[model samples]
Target: METMHKGSAGLVSAPSLREQARKVIRGLVITGQMQPDQLYSVPRLAAELGVSATPVREALLDLEREGLLEAERNRGFRVVSLSLNELNDIFAVRLLLEVPSVGDIAQGGLSDRQLDELHQLAEATRQTADTGNLIAFLDTDLKFHVQLIATLGNQYLAKLVETLRDRVRLQGFASGESPRDFLKQSANEHFKLLDYIAKQDRSGAEATIRRHLERSRGVWGSRHNTTQAAKASVLDESS
Candidate 1:
């Protein structure tokens, strides 16, 4: 009986640790702290996270299932790199899903309490962006969007959108703009969305979300260009 009780406790606590490891590692991946194409061993990551290898390994498997990482035989996991075409495809699907859904939400309208909660989340994203807290901004921004979509009560849609968002690489800010400014501008769009929803303006909400998604593509694309340019310059110097 005691053995069974201990086993039950292990089942509960194991998942808790695994989830904690998953969130931290996911944040690192999304925020570009974990570079693409690099093999990350479970032991090293577990030591860095101060957890046992079991939970870290489990967390890594979860990320692999999410398409953020790929398992390598006899090695570890590698962050998956998305091509520009893949990035564009993701945004395209997001537009088709999110724009219409947000419009529906705006027409349906949110309760005052829900709006208040959303506003708080929006403010959190803005604060993180303004302060150049990339990790925090990503976390808050994700929460804001996910919470907004949750109002529609479509669990699958919400989860799909979240997965798509996670797959995009935010390695750097757009060229010719300060990181803080670029992030702040994007963060402020959350408020515009909320305002439109509050007024039950379906068209306004749709436009705002569409523009927001397009702007994100532009931001990430510009950074991709900059990275390529830098690589070219390095090769030129070496050659």
Candidate 2:
């Protein structure tokens, strides 16, 4: 009476369904479980997730707004194909807006507990990288900076920067190398940033943040060659 799946053998966690759905869909898009540059069918995703299409559609739309997906010509949506130029530009904007925010973090100053937690987080990032856990590495990588900036008490700035955080994410995930390598580099930067902030070295923190964003820009920019993009970048492409 019902269509059966070969993977029906796998267990499904149904209680926290929406959150689970979002995680699956985000990973598919981010890690290229789904083809990039192609329209992603919500019905197909729903079937794969063993739920109705509603949550998948909702997640796709949310990612679309986040710049990971785009409204298609007739209907449905496609993963937004970012040009190397576009990705670089987005990071450039991030650097411009976020570098200055470090000053606020330095001035706001961390309590002893916050300082200890940041050190612990920084170490965790390094350990995750060494263990070659790229996905976990990315999760903490984003959490650290977002958490760091949120520490500034500038909610507006934090929210604005997050509005396009996915751009860098998509590129780096599609990037052939493990995100652990980047996270490894970033974990070290976190210590440097904290060291500056702890000393209230406002200018040094801002400069370090800018330099960090700049170096990352250079790496992503390398993948821009249309020829290189075809080989190096595309996460998925169902032919």
Candidate 3:
């Protein structure tokens, strides 16, 4: 819930201003820096990002298309809060797309060099999780999974998976466990998955992915009451 102001090193750097705005704003949304009830004016956001209004407007529109923001007439944009049912629907679709795709990748297997690179990413992801750096964890985790899927030789599938991942809102739920423990466990699963893939154990890879997704859904996508509590906590911090 930390505010990322202009010139912050945490802001994503991109080739184009529009893309930079989009990525930074998207990260804010994903990390709950942006709230659902507030209407954010373009000029204010543009100033905060140190970017032009035009690119911020375009970025907001793009996020609208991605179902992350809703525009109001004569106003600005509000974050779109996904309901529990919608979260379930997304996880179901992800299961269908990712399980088989990862299984296929495992059956084919990856080269030693590719595995080494992915291992480095996985280690970074785990380190971030261990340190409780949620933003860094998410970034490394996305790269690890997306790069793994890219090895499957299906750009369209990889892109779809990436889109689905960006849409997910990790509301910092830990179910019955401690947050640190849950995060560490989830990060370790990446290593387990890689082991399965290296051994060409198709069933093991598929099962690991399925378990991982279900665990994520259960912890990250908690009940409605918990979601509201998380939102309230974020609002309190901002206030």
Candidate 4:
């Protein structure tokens, strides 16, 4: 929950103001404060952050480069919305990275300390879910999965997975679904995945990961369908 402040006089060595602005804006996008498909004025955002327009504009351009936002002609930027197809594509990449990599890790084996750490994370994720802390649950859940992949000792692969996860997070925020049921189910699956890895059951681990991904995809798909249906109903009423 740390953010780069725009007007912190006590701070030293502010090398790149744009990078700090980018981090602040990226945080807004990730935390669901900035809704998708909505335009945000650069001047307004800068004023809110207590900085000049230049850094905010540059930061927004960086987010656009990262596929999180899109610039309008002579206007401000809009947070990009992910379609169902794009969500599926992201899951496809996750499966490509996680299933094989985590399966390998499971088969190769984990040290007792690593297993214990994963167990603790899994429990923390479940507790967060029970309390209906969606943000905390999501954060801890990502940490669990990312740590799982890190066991392979490949920084690039782990980074790829993390990027894919950030995209997935966008979809989750846009879904507008209730946190209680979906998060509880997700936490349960995390435990099952940990069990598979601890037992060195590579096949089980692979299967569990597939199910987990499919469950997440299904939840997001349901949200998208509901939104579309509501829009269609409104259109029909208007017509």
Candidate 5:
């Protein structure tokens, strides 16, 4: 069953469907509406997503293989929790993949139309930031980068980038943590990345992405630390 959200097109049983399903489930997990280690019921997810169980199951299996979920003994599939070390590991892999991929995108020389498309995405991000719509800003920011690399003409490399993005998004980044400054900072990074790509500066693009990912890791670390402290304080009060 295909239902269209306003301003969004219909979903067919195409690659687009897979991507849409992925977005829905990822948003659910990241927003904490679906907790880490909670069991994933395919039928329930399908109903929520307004799709069949097949797509839900397929999407979950794909996410599981990407290390976002684990096999549970009794409770179907359990969402994977990100420990500090695990988060660090994700950043490490991101550096290896995205940093170099950005360099490749710069050196590969995007078409004029592609460059224009990226600029439009940048403007969309800027507008989202100005309006304090951080979620939309992050979505456009991700679209800019993912579309840039995906257009670089490597299917597997694009898939790798998308998978890593799912991991990052599932960390609640889409919700924009800390303060508005953090959102502004991330949006600025995308512009900087676009500037480098526009100038065909491969090294600059690579360096910028590495820095951005490192800063992302730092922000997430701070957010987690704050959350942990708050939880501890609550426990102290309770006990």
Candidate 6:
């Protein structure tokens, strides 16, 4: 029997198939459809998606490289479980890097052209959110941050932040809040950060980054905990 799936019809090429499979599996993880600690084999995912196992296997290996999944030898992949404390630790490392970097940028100051570019990125971030293009908005947001860090003229530092940001991107999708609301909040924070940068306020910029990181951690961490608790309660009741 051919397993029918919505994603099976859109394949233009093998690479596209792999990319699509990756996105679908990532969405499953973000939405909690795929539970942590459960092994998901390539064949099972391929059957579910109505696609060949090759693309699904490649996608799982890609995700495993991203730290979101752990491959068991001779077995399948498992989504890595993250706790609130672990989330906090990620934010702490971000703060340690981002705060000083932004502060340095502020003290050094941005040229008018650079400032305008930041302003445009901030506007794009907000508009993308308003228009409900969450993924595009995230990409824009990342560009803005990467540019901000790059202003310090340290390639290694900027690259480190970029890598860390990629690792935490999944958190943006797992907030459990309404998409528009969460996106709007994120856009507002970007604008505020830009405001401090425009004024060349070192202390203000550092403080804003700290507050933003903490608030983001709190919002997503809280929602994640609530969701887990609700799931646990349901299982307990059933048991």
- By TM-score, how accurate is candidate 3? 0.83
Best by TM-score: 1
Lowest summed lDDT across 10 adjacent residues in model 1 is found at 1-10
- lDDT by residue for model 6 over 123-177, one digit each (tens)? 8899988987655676687788898899888998887887666555444354234
Candidate 4 lDDT, tens digit per residue, 33-76?
56664678888787767777888899999889878888997888
Candidate 3 least-lDDT 10 residues: 169-178
| Model 5 C-alpha lDDT per residue in residues 1-239, reported as the tens digit of each score | 12212222223566666677766665555544455535767665666666777777777777778877776654466666677777778778888888878998888778889889988987887777777654466678778778877876887877777677767645453233425676677778788988898888999999888888888788777756665676789999999
The 0-to-1 C-alpha lDDT of every candidate, in the order given, reads 0.80, 0.69, 0.80, 0.77, 0.70, 0.75
lDDT of 1 by residue, 1-239 (tens): 00111111122245389987887777667655566636788877876776789988998999999988998986888778776788788888999999999999999999999999999999999899888777678889888999999999999999998988887753533223247876888889999999999999999999999999998888787766666787789999999
Which candidate wins on lDDT? 1
TM-score computed on alpha carbons, candidate 1 = 0.86
- Candidate 1: list runs displaced more than 4 Å: 1-15, 170-178, 231-239
Per-prediction CA RMSD (Å): 7.8, 5.2, 4.8, 5.1, 5.1, 4.0
C-alpha TM-scores of all predictions: 0.86, 0.80, 0.83, 0.77, 0.73, 0.77
Order of candidates by lDDT, top first? 1, 3, 4, 6, 5, 2
Compared with the true structure, model 5 gives a TM-score of: 0.73
Model 5, runs deviating above 4 Å:
1-21, 37-62, 71-77, 173-178, 230-239
Off by over 4 Å in 2: 1-15, 73-75, 175-179, 226-239
lDDT of 3 by residue, 74-134 (tens): 6899888777777888899999999999999899999999899999999998998889766
TM-score of 6: 0.77
